[model samples]
Target: MPEPNKDEWEQIAKDYDEKWNYLHCIGALDSKHVQIRCPAGAGSLYYNYKGIYAIVLLALVAANYKFTLVDVGAYGKNSDGGTFERSEMGKRFESNKYAVPKDKELLPAMEIPYVIIADEAFPLKAYLMHPYSKAAITSDEEKVYNCRHSRARRTVENAFRILAGRWRIFLKPIETKPEIADLIVLASTCLHNMLRNTSTNISLFEGQIRMESEHIHGVANLEPIRRNFVREVAITRDKLKKYFVSDYGSASCPWQWHSIRKSRVAPRRVQYYLLNTRIRYNRPF
Candidate 1:
């Protein structure tokens, strides 16, 4: 058998990015889980809140909603923020060698932000942009930034929603090893990107994107354990009204996520996972 080379993977990443171009924007970053086939020795730790071996896929979606950098994976037990910390992208940035695409003259390479926007599950490091906690800053500027940021960050969640609805691979829990699980995810992402290129193909975003003037990406489900520990989870119905309405979900978050619970719904019962976070937005974090 022949060994795969770096160029092959790089091509995959490029093609993936092209597949996710929603409206000329490239690369939406979000973490998602794929249920595994189950490992013999893997403990409950491998089971995510989604009740599967959910590996963290740190991918970049294009403007058209095609995935580009479906290049790296992290343990399912890790949060988006934690996954980012240990990802190859993190190492590249830390070494200050993160590279931008400069191969095409027509699509000339532009040095955009090294990082992308994420939800409350992610920490507010220099590389990532998350919303502000409601208590962190109550100023008007903060409010405006939050609004704009949420708009941009919406892409991640939107992407995820589209993915789940279309693929349904993630709708169920996985039971495979972390590495093989990563391949399953990669194949799905690659398929998503390939189909995104042709408008004739029906995808998850088929009706969803048309509804909004500006399409945004979607976020993946959070671990049940980290839910209550996230400040955003701590917000009451009233706070949510104020916060989400004020675009608090967009800009200025050091917020925590609320853990998911087993409602009468079967999906709810299956959701159970946790990870140590870099930034704890609330107590017991």
Candidate 2:
């Protein structure tokens, strides 16, 4: 995938803010496991916690559900964090190679770095935001923050859903060598983006999108591993957490309070219910 220039990055961040209500978010990051038949002599290298032989499809998706970048063929045994850290995109991010727009104000005087929203599996950094640990969440503000964060991050999840739904090959274990499977995945993602760009009537596939969204598929609820983060990074998260509940911040969503309360009672059920609600209303959460 080609890297987005500074102007394109700014546009992505703007789209994310308008649609997902997450300020300065340029993309959503996630990984999906593509199952494959165990290759010759590749014993446990591709074995994952799910008891399947697979490869990791690490992706960074834009607000429109188009893949901005992807890294395929990582060992499935590795966690998303490790896979991303080793990816070419990750290395570029580490070296600040991408022409990302500089930090800007979310509110009048409070500036925050442009960030990518990920789940708990990824580390929190100055330029990346992950949810607060479930055990560490002591305030409603944190809950609100996580709710919005999940909403924004769902773009990547939905992108993967569309990819798998459209390409039936991903529904079953790819019967091929690891090298061929990698090429298949890469080509599919490229085509997926192209189709998304060219397709005129998205409503033609609404049923498939809804069906895929309703199912609780391969998501693994692993406990978030602790890692040492810089004080500035921690403070960055806290600022955004507070902003989600602040009256002055445009990121606050009125429905989040009700959603968070329902989540406290039944997390999974509320998630499923809210997802349907969004699909039905055809609007953001």
Candidate 3:
């Protein structure tokens, strides 16, 4: 896929700020496991924790539910964070090769870098953001930040959902060599973007959908960054967290407070309900 230029990146950031209320966010980053028949002589290399053989499809999705960048054919044995660290896209991000826009003022006094939002499975970076751990969250500010982060990050999840829904080939283990499976996934993602650009009714499939191997654990197992850089990234996140609750920030929705309160009172039920709501209506809590 072609890389989004600086102008395109600015447009994506604007769309994300308007639609998800997250500022300076260029895209949502995540991965999906594309199940495939065991490769010849591969042994457990393709086996995931779920005991299935597959390859990973690591994707960076735009605010409009279209893929912006994808790294396919990673062994399922690798975690999403690990796959990303080794990907060509990841290298470019680390080296500033993509020329992601310079830090700009989010408000009059608060400047922040353009970032791609991801889930906890990925490492925190200056150019990437993730939510605080649920157990570590204490303040209402953190709670609101997590809520908004999840909301914006859902774009990639929904992109995958729509892709699988429209292309049912992802419904089952693809019966082909890993190489061929990679080609199939690449082709499908390209076609998905093409169809989304031309189709007016693509939102019909945006409803709740599920896929296998959707969850992964061990965020601590991902590669570590320099201690100083980690501190810088944490400070960046704290700034954004503070901004989310400020008057200058986008106004918080009533449902966000309601959901956060429910989370403190009945965490399990709230989680269950949120999952169901996302599946049923494709709406964020």
Candidate 4:
């Protein structure tokens, strides 16, 4: 397997900023459980909260629907965040081992660190952004912030959908040992990216993206295990939220307020429905 070099990471972030109107997004992170038969004598170690025996496939996807990095074969019994913290990449990131680019400003006098987006299952680290807790979103600014955050973060979801669609093996339980299943999953992911790169047929992803914009699916909110452990992360999120409501940010998408009003949903749950509505309020974002 190839490592994601600094050049590739920078290019992914640049494309995300240009194509998704989400600036400085290095990647979107998420995990999926590859269903599998219980391993011999494992004693439910592979069983997950979803009541299935499986192995976890954690991936960081680039803006172009390619896998930037992947770690497979964690027991499904572990939470996504737990699997991530134990993954080699995750440990390296925590220890600052990767050649992450220097921090850049989102706007003049507003230096914001580049970040990866994830759902509430993950910790809100200095380099990561997750939606605000559903119970604490009390202001319109937070709502808009959540909307924009989810919008930008949906790339990984789409990537997973495309991946599973292309490789139906993931849709069914693989009757193999855990170690072999890991290799299968890795090979399938590599083929997925190969197909994406060599093919120009994007109709499948395009249609899926359109449907995603029209339907707002409910995401289960998993409370963080640790609270008040990362105050700087929260402060950074606040700054981004405030920016979303400012004239400079709104200038990129002047129609955002209209879109928000039309959606008429909670801030954390509004991004999907707000996309592609025929209200004629279009802007770059």
* TM-scores of all predicted structures: 0.57, 0.85, 0.84, 0.85
**lDDT head-to-head 3 vs 4, winner:** 3
> Residue by residue across 15-92, what tens digits does model 4's lDDT show?
886656566788899999999989889998999999999999999988877888899989999988899999997998
- Tens digits of per-residue lDDT for model 2, 1-285: 778999999999999877777878989999999999999899899999999999999999998899999999999999888998999988888888899999877667787888888987888878778988876778888777777787778789888888987898999999999999999999999999899889877654655654553342222333666788777778788888777788865334567777677655457888799899999999886
Clashing pairs in 4: none
Reference-based TM-score, model 4: 0.85
lDDT of 1 by residue, 1-285 (tens): 122244543453343333332111223467776556656776765567665665676765544566656654566777666776688765664565544332222112322233345566665544444555644545544444444445555555566667777777687765556676677777877777666666585543656564662332222232323222444332321232244333423233322121011111234334322222323434253
Could you tell me the TM-score of candidate 2?
0.85
**Runs off by more than 4 Å, candidate 1:** 1-27, 49-52, 71-73, 101-115, 175-178, 201-205, 212-285
Off by over 4 Å in 4: 203-206, 210-226, 265-285
Question: CA lDDT, every prediction?
Answer: 0.49, 0.83, 0.81, 0.79
TM-score of candidate 3 against the unseen true structure: 0.84
Q: What are the RMSDs of all candidates, in order?
A: 13.8, 6.7, 7.2, 6.6
Clashing pairs in model 2?
Answer: none
Question: In model 2, which regions exceed 4 Å deviation?
Answer: 203-224, 250-252, 266-285
Cα deviation at 5, candidate 2, in Å, is 0.7
